[model samples]
Target chain A: MNFDFTDDQQAIKRTAHDFLADRLKPDKRRELAEAGSYDDGFWNEIAELGWPGIFIEEDHGGQGLGAVELVILQEELGYALAPTPFFSNAAAGFLIQQAGSDEQKERWLPGIASGEARGTVGVVSNGEAVLVPDADSAAVIVLVDGESASAVEAGSAEVESRDTIDSTRRFSRVSANGGGEQLGGDVQAGLDRAEIALAAELVGISQWALETAVAYAKERKQFDRPIGAYQAVAHRCAQMMLETEGARSAVYYAGWTADNEPDTTPLAASMAKAYAADAGWRVTASSLQVHGGIGFTWEHDLHFFLKRARTDGHLLGSARSHRDRVAELAGLSRAAATA
Target chain B: MDLTLSPQEQAFRDELREWLEKNNPGQEPSGEQDMFKFRREWQKTLHDAGYAGLSWPKEYGGRGATLIEQAIFNEEMARQKAPGLANVLGLVMGGPVVIAHGTPEQKERFLTPILSAEEIWCQGFSEPESGSDLASLKTRAVKSNGGWNITGQKVWTTYAHEAKWCMLVARTDPDAPKHKGLTYFLMDMEQEGVQVRPLVQITGESEFNEIFMEDAYVPDENVVGEPGQGWNVAITTLMNERAGLAFGSAVAVKLALGDLMDLVRERGLEEDPIIRQRVGQLYIEAETLRLNAYRGLTSQMKHGIPGPEGSLPKWQWSDINQALTELAMDIRGPEAPTVDERWTYRFLRARANSIEGGTTEILKNIIAERVLGLPRMR
Candidate 1:
């Protein structure tokens, strides 16, 4: 059976990519990132492009597409390094659509799609990683507790800046103080959705990192040969390709699980998110090495990708956490068997 | 981005899965003769079912389906524990080359029977003198009349005794550079001077054969390409050989895993955390392979042929197999030293998996030199 992007899907993905390319320039990305102006304007741009709406219903001013569209959107954002609230708002907006009441969606979903409001989900009460399109600037924060969730307004929370390897994501420590509206149902399900979304984001980042590395390797020459012509570098690029591919597969399985197999989504997301986190870090590291010394400098374009990779490497859950999650799933199965 | 199948493809997958769910080649008796008959019959059945030539054009009696369909067929085939394909030389190499590089007459002569399973073709490579140094082989196919006289020994020929044809590579020029002198030929294995003797392997079965030739004759019509350009032609065959689906881990597939588990369980060793951990480790390796397969599939779906990234899975798989077998054999305790134990059978089989398609060392070299951009060792 065919396991490929449909023509319509491809067309939409092309449109999103073109939209990103047309709207964001390299200088603007640099300027915004420098100012740390991760804000509502960029969020508005993506929301206006109907990205946040892809998972939302048509009546809620959304596109009503599924996990496939979500992937296309994240990949485009990654391609641009757009410094937008796309990842933050879209993912949180998706959660709202999932567990929020009809009244909750009616009140916030439209504002999210229209850029009047933005949101993000923090499965970890406190995390040090900065690995999304933009996280610190979101207006609303969805926090998960076991199988339950609470939506805390960012402006109301007492926050502390955390030590971070990646500056682009700009994460913070927050004290929710039990001061928020709880999401519907158990906290574990909500945490699963949030983790899976982060995994999808990492998949996009890893893919983009691999492509950039390959292109860079092909262009940068040494000793009368393109670095890519050398097996050490070429194999790094190849391994990056392999990891990106692997991440993509894992993300897809997780994405599919997210939409259909919600009960198994946690296990699948753990696998996907864990693999993506590790792979993204690897591809980014390999890209930097392939770039050589120039990649280490902030002036070079390579650090930008590397920074995001470093940020995302520990976001949502680190590779170890996801591995533990997998172990937990296995543990559950064994215990259930004995019972 | 989307993973859903079209109605037709879904129907095809369902039909194919239903077919595979019932038919299994592993059920064939382990005897080489019995296996050969089973293989021929299975190929015929696949042909009759229009499942042959999965990626070939329809006129060649193939299904002429998309690459994914071919992938599905291969995946399902592997899943069903089918025998290694009977028509690989034809289906994977011959069919592709004939379509891309073959003469019209060659296609007309070879295409149908290949899909029909009428002729089982074996690969003639890996001479005793030229294992990793295949380019330096001295297999000479000298021009005598309108044809050629091939004088060489081809060792490690898989089932050549049962095969009707051989895809042979020989040195057409003794004076040229090592790679420059090579030529590719699709020769009749049943011809005079062609002697195929099955080598009783360490497994106590002669599954593969060695061919000895003394001035064996081949008509000019069978020549794959220009006489001096055989090296280039041979590269095409090698490239085709290098290309195939990634199985990731030998222990990953459910049946394979189950069988491995049964071995551990039958030995009453299930309580061993080390055994459980080893199984878990094998599963992760398999999952890694599965991830690589998906990545390659995603690339193919969204971009193009997955390229060298596809090779990493197999390379890692073989390395892990060698390790896994060593571990399994270790767990089997003292009974594993010789062929006295079933685990040793797996150890031997694992050894062959690396050597057969490509050796672990060569694959590592390829990954390093070609994929990684590392300098090659002299």
Candidate 2:
């Protein structure tokens, strides 16, 4: 009957938050961003620490936590923009764990939890062009063509990740041939799980962005006023703060519903994903807007959140798209999740 | 989200549900029935049976249970489609105000009967002059003797006809700040100078009233709080009022759906995509509202009594209701132009759903400025 965290869940969240904050080095983040690549050593450390595997079975080379735990761990990682293909891999791993057959889980689960296998769900691509994140970094790409699942390996990097607005987390287009196995499972199932997870990720990203913006507003002063003291800046940031919190609660409940097997769960995912995309986009835009002139500059890292947020909004699906799916689930029948 | 009730909360809900079922007189066949009176006696029964004031302090003769238990009580009552209570103002608004800011005497004198429906309460804030611009209210309460002499006109005072007491807000010092110079009082609606005029609505019913006060005497002891701090006390009532009990709104839409579908089948339009699409849209809108309700409920459980995010659900609900009823009217065709007791009446009546509590435009502004972080009007 816990709509939220038990004390044990809260404690795990606290530990995870503290662990990442304590372990992440600003210098390391700078090194990875500057190099325009991930630090494999950092990836190994994350895997060995079992942060990414919080929900993966221990036998699958991971920790055996749950959906809630994954949400907490991703939150900390997102706070730091720790250069890892986490949102992708964890989302993919959890989706497979929920909907995949034993053959499918055996094929990719261990590698993903062990950090040896990197995974990302590719929703729309023609192999000629792609808008997926970290396609270059990913080892196995879970591709969805509306309602089917397949693994496409990006063997040749013909597609390029153009100059992106978000400098911190990288996004790229994918064009690969001689690809991988086309697995079988419910594509919407994977999409729904990924949708719920992405919504939760947006919650993390939105919160960090709002908190950072608020802190920045307080610390950065103008006209002898903590710009936050000015109703103009303060209220906008306040809305961002509120929307972030509201979206977080919605996303958490979606995750909670997934964990609990509630009677009507698709609406939870739809509501979360729709709200996450809508709120993530808004808060990120507000974040950039609040930073003003400096925020407009490339030198300001504030643009990082904006880029990732915009990309995440459309990653699995946009809010409108998810909402339409919600309409289908809620209006028509509950066969989508089961189907 | 694991929203199952605890054993005791479940038991409490079972008991409440059982009682409501035995007593529940599904809405009367006649539109002109006295629901308020029926509901009042029922509430008195609840009070006597010890189910009222679930989260209030025991000092106020409440059960003094946890907020979760109160929430369970609300959800259960809402689910059962129980008769609306006449003491809503007393239970949801005035009692909370009295408990929080009322003197010990006020609590002892007001709380017990209010819960028992012995004294129905009505709010007096929205006036002919002030609505959303509430701080600009001109209701005047002049200092006189050991108390005050009030003279004001208040509109949209819901259920004032049935109420014996009114929660009044008046300007104590208009010369002070717009919000600061106010006083809140417990007014006697039956006083010599207090008059309540029915405000007829599109529903063709005086669901609320416009009350005029000329030299209405209110003793100092009846003041909800310090004289000039009335706005603060008023806000306490408003906040609790907004903490929310909106659930199962889909039921009304469900009734509408049943009626509409009967009409659809009668018109032989079941196969029509146009008709189907309208029903589908209405169904989806109703479903979306429910999902939004769940979203709000889940948040309330996590974050406590909903912040301004509460504005989002109310705003969305109004939109859905307006859109649904409008579409239903369109589906009813030229017959919609004709008003009757069937779907036409409901369509006409549901229009007020957007106006009551708050207007849709005002709600959107709240969503934009409060929830969406748009700039406030300068």
Q: Write the per-residue lDDT of candidate 2 for residues B179-264, one digit (tens) a residue.
A: 89999999998989899899998777777889999999998899988888988998888767655455545455555565676676
Tens digit of per-residue lDDT, candidate 1, span A1-339: 234566887898789878777777777777777766665666666666777778778888877777667766776677577676666777677778778888877877886766667777665444322233334566777766545667777676555655455555666666577777877744565455566666666776777777777777777878877776666676566567767766766676667666666776777777777777888788888878877888888777667767776676666667766665564453323343334
Give the alpha carbon lDDT tens digit for every residue of B59-81 in model 1: 77777787667656666776766
Candidate 2 lDDT score at position A215: 69
* Candidate 2 docking class: incorrect
lDDT of 2 by residue, A1-339 (tens): 444567877887788677667666666666666666777777787777777677788777777877777766666666676667887888778657765677878888888888777777666555443666677777777766655566765563344675565555667676555355655666565566667777777777788778777667766777766676566676577557556765676667666666666444577777777777778889978988878888788676656667667877877767666655554554333342235
Candidate 1 chain A: 10-residue stretch with minimal lDDT: A126-135
Real interface contacts reproduced by model 1, as a fraction: 0.22
Please, what is the whole-model Cα lDDT of each candidate in the order they appear? 0.70, 0.71
TM-score of chain A of 1: 0.88
- With candidate 1 superimposed using the best TM-score fit, by how many Å does residue A20's alpha carbon deviate from the native? 4.5
**What does DockQ come to for candidate 2?**
0.16
